[model samples]
Target: MPQLLMIEDDARLAQMVGEYLEQSGFVLTHATDGKAGLALLEAPTAAGLPDLVLLDLMLPDMDGLEVCRRLRALPSDAARLPVVMLTAKGDPMDRIIGLEMGADDYLPKPFEPRELLARIRAVLRRRGEAAPSARIMRFGSLEIDRDARTVTVAGEAREITSYQFDLLAALAERAGRVLTRDQIMEAVRGRELEAFDRSIDVHMGRIRAAIEADPKNPKRILTVRGVGYVFARQQD
Candidate 1:
């Protein structure tokens, strides 16, 4: 009985989705707008916060992108909660922006319930994955603890979305190897890249923001011009 929170303004769509998701053994808590959704997440009971969030891009109180930004700014671990964004907008830019805002996945409107379920499961799977080995890779002040699924810089913890962590791990695991976007996506077991390959770049930027001392001139993750990117084995 995984708990889920959905922040959507459409009553009919929420009801329909709730029913379908419940049938798949998930318990859903519905919030009609962004404020209510944020409130629920900000203050949780002893049972704790929802396992994941299904956030809609359009809300009555505030836009979903803004909501997502607020959610990521949360002080607690709730900031790392897996988020799957839903939007009617067909523009890939919206989806790209959502990823930049820390969303774990994105789904367009008029989508099949099955696809939605699959995406939710896929995101949850990634969130739940812990490295089989308790190996912590250290590069200068940066540290990637695969067993704990946490990243730290100079002993200070950094926040990164689950998807971005996987992307970073994918590069770090193959340190010094240049991997193209397609190869990186494959290594991450990502199935959500649709119509936009630059999504990888968006995620890389976010990862850099978290772990790099200066994201503007990243020394850890370097670009290979027309090729892909490689993680520098030596960092200053």
Candidate 2:
């Protein structure tokens, strides 16, 4: 059973979600405020940390975006932790901001319980696949060590969320191939791309920022206009 930490302020909704997730075989730890959630995340416990976090954008004490920013600033292991933001806001900008802040995924409010469960499962599944591997890939100044699950650019470590790393790895592994949005989502998360889903584009931008010497003129992951994106077989 995967453990999940949900940082949500609405007591009633939290309870309902907790119950639903519990029935789906997840062990949920609920925190009503950002402070409490941060405290739990920072303090090492005998039980170990939760596998994933379901963070709400609206919190009582602090904005969820601030909480996410702080969370990503933590030391190695904690900083790479996967986060999925829950928000009532339907605006695309809000979702884009959450992704820009390092959220692995996001779910809008009024979503069905099943959809939440599916998202949780997908995120967990992707995280589980990050164990060290024996292969290492090199692209000019960029190096991806599968055995370490780490990437370095120009021999220097680059900062990227685990989710973004996975996304990059997926593309690099299939370099020279143009993968559609659906293909990328299915390959990374074992899920179909939702209609008008721009999360992948946001994540790709972040990946470029970390690895490309000049993100504005990226030479690694290139867009195919209406088709999708492809990782360059050759890089500078």
lDDT for every model? 0.86, 0.83
User: Model 2: per-residue lDDT, tens digit, 65-164?
Assistant: 9999999997635677799999998899989999999999999998899999999889878876875443888888999987788999989999898778
User: Global lDDT for candidate 2?
Assistant: 0.83
Over 121-232, each residue of candidate 1 has an lDDT whose tens digit, in order, gives 9998987784243388888898999979999999999999888888899888766556778878888775455356788888889999998889999988888778688887
Give the TM-score of each candidate. Answer: 0.56, 0.56
Give the C-alpha miss distance for residue 41 in model 2, angstroms: 0.5
Error of 2 at 34 (Å): 0.5
Off by over 4 Å in 2: 133-236
Model 1: lDDT to the true structure: 0.86
